[model samples]
Target: MDIAARSPIGTRLNGLAAALGDGLRTHGHWVRAAQWVVVLVYSVLIVVPAVLPLPDETAHVFTHLTVFSQFVFWGIWWPFVLLSMVLVGRVWCGVLCPEGALSEWVSGKGRNHAIPRWVRWGGWPFVAFVGTTVYGQMVSVYQYPKAVLLVLGGSTVAAMAIGYWYGREKRVWCKYLCPVNGVFNLMSKLAPLHYKVDADAWRASYGPQSALQNTPPCPANGAPNTARTVRIQPVNCAPLVAMRKMEGASDCHMCGRCSGHRDAIALTVRSPNTEVVALGGHLATGWQTLLILVGLLGIAIGAFQWTVNPHFGEAKQWLAEWLIDREVMWPFAENAPWWLLTNYPAQRDVFSWLDGGLLVTYILGMGLVMGVGLALPLAGATRLLGPWHTQRFYHLSQALIPLAGCGIFLGLSALTVNLLKHEGVPVYWVGDMRLLLLVGANLWTLALAQGVCQRYATSRSRRWLAQAALLPALALVNYQWALMFWIW
Candidate 1:
């Protein structure tokens, strides 16, 4: 076959793959299957354990539900969280997240401009829902009885209201509110994935280069130019007639709705020669919802296990007894536990001081390490990629936030497993294997961030420093949380 003929064949194969992926997403019946699995687990793992007399159950999973709180608890959770974010890019927002899914279902695309009367009138109920749920945890309600109803009602009303409001614009709740979304928006820096726009193609499509001047009016009727967070310059569009006439054309979700094109790809390649996209309200991907959901699920499970397990104390006692009962190679070690207490009165105090001191030291040290790390790289990125106004630092920072969150998460997980083991907890404590996994994952995540960062900040030093800077901040944050436990 001629080379030209082969090129067309390759193009056709690529298009086929893109279409197949889109078909699966558009129909999304498989996602419904996934939902069923979630439902089954919710029933079997979450509800059953709650209602029935399970021996070791005590909301062991519920604590993990609070994604923000997990930052305070364990680091092992970070790698899984990173993996989910990279795979789906926020699928958690659409399908898996119970809250977002419920919001979407209730609001019914939220495009209508008219605000629902119930939401406008009953706003406080939504506030009450959040308050009551958090308060329930603080007060140790064990289970939310009437609180579930409150959640349902408030969600319905809020969905109607926010849905109506955002429907008039685009993803209003996700951009301005939705605490979980906010976390994703902020922590997305730690993510190993980023949205890439073909700048040359976009410029060909729309000539003017302002955020407002470049893209078309949102067909979804979302907010106009203000919604452009990612570089929506005229540089990245395919010059299709319909696309060429549109301003803010880069806000296209690559949903492939406008131009009859299917080139947008989720690549294994860490970086693409393209424009960096940001969380402008006008566009969202299928994966955003997914990441949020999976993370939430993990958080819920971790929380229940960590905070509320009824058998935790008993489990610790059994572990202590078993170790004491044995008389093998380390008999002297066995006797030392008793002797250390009797002979060395200051051992406990000394250990407490050591723990607290180490935690504080890590916090300060990690902070400095991250600050210097990122600054050096970021400065370097600017020096290497400079002269063009294209390398924007702020946008790069956003993409790396999630990865940074992951690094800190791993650091904390290590510390958490350490503390749990010390307390005689029977959980799988951190070891060489898990630590290696964390390091490898975070490094890949950092590379991805740097690739994206280079496009934004031309200074080589700045890029290098910024990329390196993130880890220490994460480490410091983790250390700060660990100190809280030690202090209390």
Candidate 2:
């Protein structure tokens, strides 16, 4: 019934999409094989590096296993994975994630108990993301293998344990507790491709007689009578998504498991802004808004900026002087173990109590400041459009996803540049590339804001007013990036 399905080109596209989906359904073993391959590579990258000696200053990624693992995990793997969410949704989560695979595998043979209410809490994604992000920063997870082991390895173990105790063959941890689930969900809203579900087709397929229309009678029924109807076997979605009701890419893992189910779902192309512009307002939540403004824009920036920010050093010095004047030295003298803090005496990397406290304070401080800063313009935009609507505010906030996602990508790719620099690889264009990405992201964000405003504002004048109120927010975001990439 779709317009695209009526034309020859559209028909070909649909055929390709159907083939892609049905192939996954019929040849599931291929997907399992791919999952195992990723799991094997992931195991080596996560486990092997943690036990190996730290790469020396002179070592290169190609020449050293430790450095290679670090490059692969932080530089190439994570940055590209984040980008992939925008390009093709959470294919990485469903197809290639070792933790998801392991969790689902363990879940298949475990107790298969009902999910606890607390485990299904809506705020878990936000809390888990913030917790893991802060903890990773505190322990310098990006730089140290022991810290990586404790953070990422520990997360894997917890995922498996949660699987063992929770739902049968489901990604319980990924659904509610994965540290990056909230982030991926937000980013995937911009993905150009997703599993599109046809509600009418699904309903038709579920009709009393439709399920038995094409199939032979079951042996249990003992006859092939046309009068009998049977229920269709349901798709066993690992993420436990309600396939027929799915409307957005935010939660769908893009595993293709439920694709073509009831002749409804199919992998389809769409505009990048389709999800946010069309459905964001209706589906937006306070937690997602907080995750965007506070978690990503605020805490993430602070975490990445602290190392390079001259202000952090200046503040640390001022505090150190004050503590010394009062003979308060313990905070400066004591450091936690590597698992708890970034302590590696041989590598001359250690975080004293003062360092740890200040780091947490700074990150949280950034979150509060940035959250309030971004929220003001959004609040203004919401009010400008009409009465103060919380949903409207959340909808407008979705426009910032492009900028927020871009900032995180830039921050992560900085690690890639740093690693390449260590290997004597010239990356002189990195700054130019960052600038282009920032500009493009800002433009994309503004365009999305315009699209959202059009939906809410009844008149051109009102829409313009709403957009005017959003400029300050965009400016604030840009200013933060300027500090990190240019001013600092």
Number of backbone collisions per candidate? 112, 0
Off by over 4 Å in 1: 1-17, 29-82, 109-176, 185-396, 399-402, 407-429, 441-488
lDDT of 2 by residue, 121-193 (tens): 9998889989999999988989888788788889999999999999999999999999999999999999977
Extract clashing residue pairs from model 2.
Answer: none
Question: Which ranges in model 2 have alpha carbons more than 4 Å from their true place?
Answer: 1-11, 208-213, 216-228
In TM-score terms, which candidate is top? Answer: 2
Q: RMSD in Å for candidate 2, one decimal?
A: 2.4
Residue range 407-486, candidate 1, lDDT tens digits: 43453355456545544577644444445654564555465566665545546776666566555533443343334333
Candidate 1, overall lDDT? 0.38
Worst 10 residues of 1 by lDDT: 266-275
